[model samples]
Target chain A: MTEGVVVVGLNHRTAPVEARERLAVPPDGLEDAVRAVLALEGVREAVVVATCNRVELYAAGAEAESLAGELRRHMHARGGSGVTLYEHRGEAAVQHAFRVCASLDSLVVGEPQILGQVKEAVAAARSAGALRGRLGRVMARAFQTAKRVRTETGIAEGQVSVASVAVDLARGIFGDLMGRKVLVVGAGKMALGAARTLARAGASLLIANRSFDRAEALAREYGATAHPLTDLGMLLQHVDVAVCSTGASGYLLTRHDVATVMKARRGRGLFLIDIAVPRNVEPAAGDLDSVFLYNVDDLERAVAEGGRGRSVATIEAERVIAEELSAFRAEELAQRSAGPTIVALRRRFQEVAAAELERSLSGKLRHLPEGDRAAVEAMLDALTNKLLHAPTVALKTAAANPDGDDVMRAARSLFALDAEPADPRGEVTRMRVQGEMTAKAKAGNGR
Target chain B: MLVGFLAAAALLYLIATVLMLTYLVGVASTLPSRRAATVSLGAAMVAHVTHDILRWVTLGRGPFAGIHEGLSTLALLVAGVAFALRLLGRRLETLGVFVAPLTLLMLLASQGVDAQPAAPLSGALLGVHVGSTILGTAAFTVAFALAAAYLVQEREVRQKRLRGMFQRLPPLEVLDVASFRSIALGLPALTLGLVTGLSAGLQEVGRGIPIVSWRHYLALGVWAVFAAVLALRLLAGWRGHRAAIGTIVGYASAVMVLVGYFVRGARL
Candidate 1:
């Protein structure tokens, strides 16, 4: 049988966030979910990659169709309704895994968080004892491929998030952000995210909110100081970048306030990131000298343009994924054939040992007690196991190399193990061609 | 032998300029090392100083005597000021992408000046006049580089295309402050230099020699432009792109005054 990967998942494109949440595996529940999936029939290895926008189970096994059904039942018991489940097997599954790890399949393609989430999923499965062998190797290689894609292609080019784009705009206006002071007008999510990005870039953060306690709470989280809303004017004068995402009915910062601040600032450039829905900063404030104001719409336009630029690099990104998938498939094929070859070789050794033990038990050991005869049989079995240990390890090691099939062929012919049943998928024949071509290429290159 | 040193300095300046340009364009995956660029530029300055001293010794005159010496001295002063500003902070180092090429051009132009027999010694007034003006022009050159960078970076912000070159430049505040400080120092030097030149011209006229030329008037015009920029900035708070463009115009006039010497084929 051909061993392949199977992915059964539901993402933002296939289901709404509400539906995804119903199937999402919480951090505390991840190990249990992975263990449950591994207990199912036909799932040789399992990893549950669950996030806010997606819930997916990836497995490596002989049967994709049945394994997907088993995963679907697991997902069904978890309370997802009206959600479309996507099932990808073999090459499609491998391709899907690569694309997801590379962030090409994210809701916002080219976003970088998915790769880290995938790593976390793999770690959880490993701790849960559900990740092993072929699946583990494939996932580890997928992480490397993701990193290569990020470095070699523009897949991760530009800031795609509104918060990050705001920070980028601030840098453009301020050059280096180190030691620059930033003022947050509210403690809302968008404002906080933008502030965090700026703070990470070395800008000092000052949080100002309507509620003093709320501002203090967020300030402690970011290791920043909190100020009252009334201090906005003083803060604006001292800050290089100010982000406003207040939940107010009117503008939090008006043209007159910024004009006064600019005079105090001596016309130093002030970047204002207004991410609120109703717009916190006054539009006319941007008209003031040395004030660069970008509302949510402007940030979205930048994000959209950046997305379009990244789409241009998709062809190259897809080519990278294709190369990684081919390597993974070849390795899987070799491992599959090597596994059966090891089993057949062990069986052949056991048959000869058992035959020799049977003759001794019936003739020479006939006078011995029943307990001694059983002990002799156990010794023969142990000897057979001990003899196969080095060869088993050698065969697996050879399978990882280019000429692994030669070793398999020699062992089969030498032990007459070919008469025994082996892998039903015909991987032996595929590996034969692959190994011979590789060896031939190496020989030709040497000459 | 002096030409060989000049060639080495020019080559080093060219490399530094190329590295800075590459950094501005964001073509390199990693940032080009600042230490390498700084070392290259510093070595270039040392060689240029060596070339100037050697030429001074060989010619047995001051480095400001002829068009050749004037150009070389001007290049050295401009590059030295730029290097000093860079040592103050890295934000000004990007200005080298503009300053280094201009320095190389001046050095190259110096080679084109014809060697001539030394004239009779000039008065102390003439020495004071020429030295102060050269120093003032060097300060103006540094100001001009900062202004150009400010305009480029400011345009990127206004257009909201914050990538590549925009990302490499100093902040608008930093550029604006540096430009103003340069003009603040340069305007006084230039004013003093112009006054000395006027005094020198009066002395030459007393001796019945014509010393007032278009270059003198152009130098006065350059002073007037910077004076107006400084005056308006102090009076009206003119501090951004408009101020930058004004400084650039002033620097342009100063450069034209230098070019006037080469065009007239006269000794300074």
Candidate 2:
């Protein structure tokens, strides 16, 4: 039977936010919980990746099915009852690990936060001494895949967040915003956020609202100038950029006002960002020479476009993940298949050496010296290592390939290792031979 | 050697034209491939330069003296400048596709014309006129490339709703600024060139070519169009699609003057 790693848990898809919150492990409790998972019968290794959107326990064991049920029970006892658990073994586990790290499986698709979270989880597991061998390899592969996905895909094309989208449009018009004027036509949360984004980009800020007092108070936070709505026309002629998000029912700046401002500014380019629900800048104002207008809908369209671009990257990432996992699974299976034969071969060699030593020392060497006997034993040990070196290397190479099991069976039959499955000393020989063959297969396939 | 070089340059010109068409139709993905196409044109340019240099060395006179050699040398200069810009990371690769074909056409037309050099001019004023006009033409060649990129980008954004193309191309605002930047630089150069040409004509007195000849008139018209574009951009903030189209028109008229000279030289 092939030994494998399995992960089971509920994410945003299988569980609602309330259920996930109840199941969420505090960062401090993660290590202790992972230890508890290792305590389960047949669990060789374990790690818990817990986030706001997902709670998954990844475990490796000879008896994966039993370990999975135990993990599910532990999660339920921790108050995550009735949550769906998807089981992935071997290659499936590897691919799932990569997908999680890449953010292809993220709720926001291409948002870059999840990879760091996964890295933290892996680090915590390593420090706890719970990560070893297969689990460590899987985690490393996941990190690599995530990096490749970012480099190869246009997933991160446009700004998805509101503040960033505003900044993007602003930069498009102004090129470099340093020393440029940006007028904020409202003092609401979004306007404040947009103001912060613009100010950070080195644009001088002007806040205009119907309630001048609130606008003044908000403007003071970023050291910006404040103006009442009546002065917006005058402000428009001076500012290079404007962002309007007033909860106005109708247009605050009409075509006539924009035309007059354009004439006054002598046709210097103006960028208008309208974030209000009912729309603040009149659509006709866009027709003015040197005027560029973008409403909420345009920003939303850009976000959607960014999302689509990320999806294309996601497809490419999934293909890479699948290929990597398949290679990993094949290597694991090959090594596992060669285990018994390697042990048998080593045991047989030791038996022959021991018999020869007993015969030689009983009378002929016994009459000589104890030092002489010890020297002969040392010589025998060296001879055994030298004789076994090539086969051992070959077996290990075979064990690491996709078809490693076939190589292992051939090695076992050729060496007559199938005759003895028990006896620890004999089993060592069998497993050693099998391990070497598996390793050899892996090496050959790699070429 | 001259004939072999001319043939290779013509072949490269044809390849660049095909590649540019493929790129404009959205069949190609990377800008570097278009840039590679220009490298081939650059190889062709090396050959064109060699041909002109060989003629000058063998005949023991400046290649710019005859209408045949003058037009050919100008074409070689244009291609050389275009290749230099491509090396400097200017995306004027597509411009070579348009320019190399025009250059080759001029060179081929020159072969059929009178090979004799023009009667030597009397003063340094004529040299200044010729030098400035060539420099102005080179500047306009770059302007034409920027205008072409703008037009292609505009069409792709409008017709395909292609976010990839939209993002890949510089922003519309950036393109408009670049176009103005080119024209602003080119206008003064052309003005100096035109003024020097008029001065040269005055120095020659009755022996001077007519200012109202088709070649001179086309050059004047091209200068006027560029002047108008610069005024509109500065005074009215004319930009985007309209500005791009204006640059294309202005540059096309300038190219017409070069073609006019070629045809007239052939008949003579």
Candidate 3:
């Protein structure tokens, strides 16, 4: 059988988010999307991971080059011609899967959510019957590799995002947010995201936006309280964590205002996360005792620190992925070698056993006692098993080693089972040619 | 033969420690690395048990006769308990990196203590005192390991660098709960140990040797630290980094009590 895995699509690195969004399928539509990709010619299996930042389609088939083209056409038909696509076949495809699952290829490397997103995509494809054969196994192995990369490497360590870093700093101040109050100074998207993160960490949310309607609406969504922007100082005294994001040109809270708030709070540590562009919270406020003020620059520094940590982990994860890829390739080759040959060998043996039984039953065995004929059939079954057991074991053992293809080819030809399975020599030659072509293309693209 | 067994067990523990550290460093793949370390530890445990059995049968005495034997047994119990925790799906196997090296040290420390044949004592109080204290110490070792992991994980979160070794560790809440649970389990054992030890000391006092000693005071110190830790945790909602640090301090005091015995050259 022809076998290969290929991934062809665009991500945030290759295409803009708008292009990804155009191609993006929601969770509910993922199954239909996977089925759509599977419907493309020459594609045996397909899974589409469509997140906000990326849209990737991974397909496995006997002919990778054609399948990649078909996938490109399918994506273009769905997402428009403007979407820039990248293609990875064979070992590269498997590596891409591992990296994607491990979150190394994410918009923000080491982010944890990509693994879950990939798993969800695979699940959707499986439910739709779009994932089958070696592709499913490959994806499953990818998940395991992803999990390994996560635990073994610091790839997923630290809070890389601005909002999450704010939440993390807040957590450092208060070990657990069980009954801690969090105040949102503005009801903008950044503030909303920060509030949601704090809320998820079990902090009580209170929204105070200049626009009362927006504050009330956002607060109602989170089942939180809404206060007027005029009462920000009073709210700060009551809350442990405060997130400020607004469109104001000047600093929202001066150092004096924060110092006053700290005095009223009676030495309770106040964490202020300022995510505004023009700087919402005063910089000098961070110097106050019991006040932990982190503006956009500070959050970026935290993010950069996390990025450095992940980079160190990424080197280790890359090494692990390389190891996994080699092992996976060997296993894939072994399975590909043994699969059709095993089936054909079993069929040939069964056929011979049945013919012998039929001939004996119709002639000499027909005259024997019923017990004797039954005994003969049982003997034949045992004989077949005994005859095949050694070769079956040997074939499987050879498949686990480097000389698997040679042994598989020898067994196929010796047993006259060459017609069913693909010629090993021919497959190897094709793979080698494809590999060389890919290398040339890469070298050319380097220019 | 017993020495051979001890050396082999120590070597196996060293190998397991190396494997665990490799896994902790994130260079090794997750599943195979953990499996290798766990198998090595299991083999080491088997070797350890064999050594203990041979020492007991050959010497015609209980396992806790000398500091040499007692330290070996203490390491075995600590490792066995940590292995059991691993089996319970606690995701605490990474702690083997700490536990294995410490266990090896404990086994090596046994070499320094003279292995004189212990006289057969004719009292149940002695057995209760020694056995309960050893078991309590094992429980504390496990708790200390968990507390150490909890603090490391807490630091990673507080610092905002989340990959590699940090990712391999159990979550903060899980480690916190496990640390407290180990302490909870240990406290009762320790109390029983202290009660039995005091009783045994009274019996000894009647025979002319003083009941109170430096070890006795150090034991009280261990108990006091744990009591304060547990009380603060239960009543005042003391959980997280501070609680973990307290657990470490408490375990340190417990270790110091053992050191007190070692320094005084006492064998009981």
Candidate 4:
């Protein structure tokens, strides 16, 4: 089930966002896209994962590598023409699926949205009747792999954006943002961004701007209060965090202003976020007691640091995905290799039991009643099954390891079963041919 | 027998300290996990209190009597206060990095001093002076440890390069408040100790001792440092880094008083 899995598409890394946007299929268009891929000859099972950052088609079939070209062509025709595409086949393909589902392949390596996006794609493909057999099992196992990665690793530990990092810094200072008061100095984009994150963290926000109208407008959105810029002093004394992004030319709040407010708050910690262009808050204000002030550059540096921290976890996540892929492949190979061998061994033993029963019934048990003879034949068949059970169990159990394939071949040859299952699956072909020859032999003998 | 318990406690404290360092390093952490370190520290504290009680009973005197007893008692007080704070659910247990080793050091320092027991503290004023002074210094010791934590956490926040050991600390606000509270507790105790000491000095003037000995002056110094910390925190906005540094300085004066007693009592 893990083998012959293929993914052919372009992501943010392989193609630009413009290219990705061109190739992206809308949510409603997903089933149609997957059905189109399934219509191709060598694509037995198919799914289309199209998000803002990537567009991919996953397929499983007998000739999966061949389907990669067709999937690429199909994607190009669906508006990915100028975009470069990448393809992974077989074991590499299975690993690519795991990485994608785990979000190691996303532009933001540990972002969580990719997992749900791919899950939707799988659902869409299932709806289109294109998800069955190997591809379906592979995706189900991929979800399991993704779940393990999320729980077992620290890949998603830190906030990566400026606004979210502001929240993280506040929590580091205050432990919890619940009921914490945040003062936004100006109604600019950066200030609004920071205010939104803080308000979402359960903080009560107060928007203060020179234009009272802008403050009131932003305040209405957060269900918070609006105050004029002149009220910054009284407001600063009350709030735990003050985001200063005003467009004032000089220091709107000087070191002395912050120091006075700190004294008013009785030295309770105040976090000042100066994300303005001309830097509204004075740089020296950070030196005051219980005042933690961070400017735009400092916040950006912290954001970058968070990115570097996740890279270490990214390596750990990669190791996890590698382990899951190998485990998945081993289990799949065990079923593929041991399954047919077990069947052939059981057939050979049952045939021998049947021939002996026929000879005995005709020559020695000629005087027995019909019912008694039928019980004897049932007992012989049960003996053959019991005899072959141990070897069948051993062969399948051994198939879970690398050397299990060799043991499977040895078990086949020991039973005089024709050919090996590993040689492009010649065991099935040989079994079919042998069955046909056996039918001809029975006809010629006319027993 | 007291030495036996002390030695066992010192050994346990050493093991607990080493285990804590390893736990911080992310190694040697298994089923006998962080809980083992906490248990060992608890046992060490138990043995420490037992050693103090045995000596107190043997001599029929409080631990405030002499330099050895005073240092040993101070060590126990610091550990007890820190452990209590942790049990109160403040995320400040990392202060044990300073408390544990300092307890061990003080125990060894106490043992190095003369062993002959000083007579028990008599006269209510003198007893109060000794008791409150030692208690006040113990509180200062806690403030000192918290100040160190505040400095580290403050640096991490100020420099904006928060990596390992940064997240391990309690938030800057928590550390600042905790350090300030320790100072708050110490200030009153030291003030009471000084007032009683002054009353005694005025009543018994120049009786083989000057009214203002070096310890009296040092106690005043510690008092003044904490006084400035509190007044500035309330009046001049001195609370985070500067306040932590001030608390550390105040605690240093308290340490000087202990060293003064330890050295002077040994010579006597």
Candidate 5:
């Protein structure tokens, strides 16, 4: 779990929306809210991601339990009073952040807005001076992982609603509905939604209905041309897509009427979306060449199929997240162990280089001039840095692996920088090196 | 050196076809396999073009004077056109799945045929005659591939089976329009090809060479089928499934004409 990271929050799954809305902090109040949370005892750094569906607080401290407790108490005092608070410690907390940024933890799994919300949260915390070190890196990496999930999988590929499916179907039939004619056969609520979506896609909207006044009302609202139901045939001949969401008892568009329109248009494809309970378009009309007629049942079936596809893509995204998480952990471990080993190895090389130089100066090179002696000492220090360069880099890479302890131990033994207490003579070498460093600092000051 | 280039091109086309199939069948990831297949196919086309040029230089004539050379030229044209469309910003790389296999089969078939060059052409006119005919056939080949994709995609949408390869295929409208445009381009080229071909045959007859009646009839029949497909679309508003089927039939007829030439002993 990497020791001290923690998350305490309540979400759609843990508590009802009523409880969630109570604790939901708006964007303007987010910085102040996160600052208050940071003021709590044991919470070192805090980022509060407050969205409509979730309110999660991510914090890091010396102890996870104390951090979670402080954050949870502060949260309860400020409006989390009745809701159940959930907590995840250390590595699980990081994983939760990853999932939230990836949108896998959203109320609607794979919805894209959560990523932006988390980015905003991180920004708020950073401006509040609450983001530092591991938590900041984790948030940045979380964004990259989320981007990978988006591009590498089809998690956001299909439409899940009947109204949106109508748009998808039309786009499938006539790509880039720009300036294409769209005829909404009824002014029902569902038809209004379908028409609004199509109009946004740049289609020229036409609303036709049995009640000309109702059609005109919807047409005025949507910036579309209004037509009486009697003109449906004329509209069908020119319109590329027809959304049928009427309250008709029998078929609003039968096989014969569509076939006649298809001929009148001279073989151009016709996409008819019949989102009605009684099924407005005749099911057999879909069989005609270039005619795609989808009723409410078909659209719902497509939604269900899209859900299945989303699930599969979600599984693929999770695998990518898991792989990235493991990589992060290994690298984090390596980073933690590598820093001290690098310092000790460089110190050891310097110590040995200094000791040998002293022996040479006293025993054989005693007659060398003062200037020549200083040159030899400077060259020896440079050689020590150059000699330890490769091992220092390698130890950092080798040591944080799940099975990296052997490499760390081997490095310690090879350099005589043991975890065990050093002998009296070894202590003498370390003190001599420290004193030499202090003298070099004074010598630079004198120059 | 010529054989080496041909073998490499064949292998690359095989790789691209296999990679595309894996992606379409959902056995592989999307971007990697698609990118690999595109690279492999692009390399194959380069090799195929190199081999065609080398043969042309060695023989001191056009490449399409025999079945092997003619089919090789056709394969290059099909892959080159489809690849060119992708480079031009048309999102039709998925069509490479069909293009690669067809190109590979043609290249392999070309290798299988006897490598016998025809008598050197008398003039530029005959070269134009042969080149236009092959060019028209290549456009038809591309149209045929689009038609096949359209039919598969149409079946999926019509049957409400929107999973697997259904998601991978281009929209039905895209396939339909691309296939139509190919034919719209093909018909004029085929018309010129027929005219030049007839003129050349007439010259051959004047030189006391026996005229092949069945070859002329097969060429005319392929032209008629393609012509009908276009006429039906323009006049009767026929598109989608029927238009796709019609284009496929036209391609089949065109292939039969090629078979007529191939069976007549590499006189293409």
Candidate 6:
């Protein structure tokens, strides 16, 4: 069977944020939770990524289907009872890992938070001893691919957030915003966010909402002054930029009000950013001389354009991940085969040496001194190496081939090493095998 | 030689103008077989330069003299600059559609007029006025072409609901600023040209002579329209489609003045 990784979970795709949140583990609890998952039956290694948008567990095992069911039950027991699950094994798992790390699977397609989330999850898994050789290598490759996608494409170019888009449109008209005054037309959260971004960018701010107290509170948060909606025209004359995101159903800035302001201001440019759903600025404001206006739809278009370019970069990133995962899988399968082959070869050599020592020591070595007998035992060890040299070389050669697993099973049976299995209940058995593999790999690297 | 050069140059410009129209109307995706549209425009510029040089060599004077030569040289300079900008990889091929036709019209109109050179001025003031005005008008021609492109792009976006085209065009704000800057550069040069022309006319007549011809009236009208455009751009902050329209109107009036001068003699 091909060595592979499998992940099963529901994200923004199969479950809403409410369902995802119920099953989410805090970052501090991630390592302990992943450790519990690794203790489950048939799970060899595992990593769990819990976020506001998703709660996914990625595991590597000889029996992926059984382990995936155990993971689903684990999540269900953790209060994800109604959450749906999607499972991907082998190549699909590799591609999905890359997509998640690159933020293509984000709530807001290219949000940049998913990469950090994935890295934190991987680090937690490693500390919990849930990430072993193959899965660890794959996760590392995924992080590198995400970095490549961010730097190579125009994917990250242009204003991506609503506030940035508002600021960009304002800059288009006024050329600069250092001393320009911006009036926020509502106390809504989006308006406050946009106002804050503008304020940070050096535009002087004024907040005007229908409720005087709420506007005053928001204005105080950003060190700005507040006004009521009745003073909008007065505010319009004083400020060069207006951002409106009120809950009102109709237009707040009417044609007559704008016209009156335009006449009063003597034709200085006015940039209006209307981020309300139904739009707070009148469409006709765009027709006025020196009045440049943009609505939510325009900002959405800018965001969508940026998302599309990022999607293209995501394709290149996924390809890199796939290549890395394949190389890691090949190395894993080779190591798995090498384990049984080396164990069997060692047993066969030890058996032959024991039989030869018994035959030689029975009469002549029995008459020697105790120190001389110890030297004779050491001499016998050097002789056994010369005896089993050909079979050892052949076993290693067979284990390196693509069909190495079949060759390994054959070697195990021929040498009768499988007569007794490594103790499945002994955790030390698996730990020792891992330690030996690391040592062998290190020795090979030294060569 | 001058007539032959002028005929060849006008024909080349007319062909380029048609190709540019084709490209602008979205019928041709790529320029026909000549590698790119820039090559066709470059060929037109070469023929245009040949026409200007032949006129200058035959008349034994710069082509900035009478109205016919002045308009022809202005048109040639505009096409040359536009072509040079394209060669520098500005993707200004769409602009050629608007400018080449204007250039061709000027060249063809020049063909029907007399080519008598201007009387030599005793002062360097006239030379400075003529050189600056021609360069300024050349800049205005480019501004007009950019404004026309912006208007067409904006209309396309509104009619087709193509958001992509909206992003592709220079922001309406940038187009407005460019139009204002070009006019700002052109207006002072035109003022100097008018002052020098008045002084020269007064010198020739030995007194204040009554300006009676249509050419003089057209020149004064073109200057007045540009003056109004500049004043509104600075004071009123007029921009976007309205500014684009104003630029087109002002440029058309300026071209008409050149045409009026070609129909009547320079000294009329």
Chain A TM-score vs. truth, each candidate: 0.55, 0.57, 0.61, 0.62, 0.62, 0.52
> Candidate 6 falls in which docking quality class?
incorrect
State how far residue A152 of model 6 sits from its true place (Å): 20
Tens-place lDDT digits, model 1, residues B1-268 = 9879999999998987887777666665254466677788899999999988887799775776654676788899888876775677655667888788878877776676665412222566546555676677777888889889988888777667666666667878778877888888887877777887677676777789867767678888999998898888887777887789999899888767556554554445
Per-residue lDDT tens digits of candidate 6, residues A1-447?
223477888875576434655676766889998998898888888899976567889888776668778888988888657767788876567668877887766544555667887899999999888887667876887787677766764344521556766665565445567887989997655567777788888999999989999888887888999899899988999898888877665678777778888878766667777765445677777777666666655554555554533455556655655665565455554555565556556655666677777777886567787788788788878877776676666666665566865876786668655554333454333443664576466434322
What is the C-alpha lDDT profile of model 2 across B15-51, one tens digit per residue?
Answer: 7666655654557747777766776777777777777
> Candidate 1 or 5, higher DockQ?
5
Measured against the true structure, the TM-scores of the candidates, in listed sequence, are 0.53, 0.54, 0.49, 0.56, 0.57, 0.51
DockQ of 5: 0.38
Worst 10 residues of 6 chain A by lDDT: A420-429
Model 1 off-target regions past 4 Å?
A: A1-179, A197-204, A210-235, A248-264, A282-288, A295-447, B1-23, B26-47, B66-68, B81-93, B108-124, B160-163, B205-210, B266-268
Q: Order the candidate numbers by TM-score, best to worst.
A: 5, 4, 2, 1, 6, 3
Give fnat, all candidates: 0.39, 0.16, 0.06, 0.57, 0.61, 0.20
Q: Give the Å shift of residue A415 in candidate 1.
A: 46
Model 6 gets an lDDT of: 0.68
Best by DockQ: 5
Kindly report which residue stretches of model 6 are placed more than 4 angstroms away from their true locations once superposed.
A1-183, A187-231, A238-240, A297-447, B1-8, B11-35, B83-97, B117-136, B139-143, B146-165, B195-211, B234-243, B259-268
Task: State each model's CA lDDT, in order.
Answer: 0.76, 0.70, 0.75, 0.76, 0.77, 0.68
Count of backbone collisions in candidate 2: 45
Model 3 DockQ (Cα-based): 0.04
- Higher-TM-score candidate among 4 and 5? 5
Interface DockQ per candidate: 0.25, 0.11, 0.04, 0.32, 0.38, 0.12
- Model 5 C-alpha lDDT versus the unseen true structure: 0.77
Give the CAPRI class of candidate 1. acceptable
TM-score attained by model 2? 0.54
